[model samples]
Target: MMFRKKFVLFFGFVLFVTVAGAQDRYFTKTGKINFTSKAPMEDIEGKNKTVTAVLDTKSGALQFSVQMKSFEFEKALMQQHFNENYVESDKYPDAVFKGVIANNAAVNYAKEGTYTVNVKGKLTLHNVTKDVDVPGTIKVNGGKIEASSAFNVLLSDFRISIPSAVKEKVSNSIRITVETKLDPLKG
Candidate 1:
């Protein structure tokens, strides 16, 4: 009958949509990023919890965006100097990374497991972009994907300069750690 054929077609369309949506993408708005600077005179640390990240599960593509002013430091003066002088947040408001997982075939997204992979991307900070390859871990647990990485960024690479007066208080390289729990994108 015509009604029976129409019902079958509608059911097939819905099933196709559901399957396509399941593998679409994953994203998070409240990711966490931390940076630390260690020197003989002092240790400086800052944290930003307002980072946004997206991962395309079907293509192994990953991207992140972080506002420079969102980073909170322990000392108010240090934070002020960081934005106004070092990072120049007014000119370069956000830092971004866009790239893909190099070893995508090793991980099974449907199954629950932790996989170590290499991420090659362009990191843009303080108006400078650099290509970097870093080791990261992707953990799939309970239908959620958690991606994390720890890496070092050199100040000179981003054109960040340290004042001579406080040169001893800061490190030339900063240690950065990123962690995010991503959920499937909903339509």
Candidate 2:
């Protein structure tokens, strides 16, 4: 009986360790966002250099963050405007998201499958914080995991003051896209 108890304990310990190590980390140095506005008329898109995403299978937890200063556009002047007047990247250098997949057990990272999940988290930009619910797609194929999410942020929510000179040139909403390859977390 004692031997059986010891075996059970050992098995349980191993299971715990295995489960803990199953979290996956997917990262990218280039994440993109595009903004389009009418009237004054402008098209803007930028890429960030530091982006990290953490996914936990057991808990269906997802956390992501990016450095605001990393955003770079084709035009140097436009990029400067974005950082200085729009995003104020120097002041609010990072944007973070923390949430869980609504359907925890429905996603299987080990096999090829597509799962639609609702992600709820706080998004901070230009020193303003807002709660958001975003829909995302998670696909696991050939031992690789790809996560994609698109969300919109309102300029007013972030307190980004639009200058009267170009008030109509910028859009009130900004669209963001996140994509990356996930790597299994180590013990």
For candidate 1, write residues 1-187 as lDDT tens digits.
Answer: 9999999999999999987876669999999999999999999999999999999887889999999999999899989999999999999999999999999888899999999999999999999999999999999999999999999999999999999999999999999999999988876
* Residues 63-105 of candidate 2: C-alpha lDDT, one tens digit per residue: 7777777777899988899888887888888877778778767
After superposing all C-alphas onto the true structure, candidate 1 shows an RMSD in angstroms of 1.7
Query: Which stretch of 10 consecutive residues in model 1 shows the poorest summed lDDT?
Result: 17-26
Instruction: Quantify all predictions' global Cα lDDT against the true fold.
Output: 0.94, 0.74
Candidate 2 lDDT for residue 56: 73
Question: For residue 183, what is the lDDT in candidate 1?
Answer: 88
lDDT of 1 at 101: 94
Which one wins on lDDT?
1
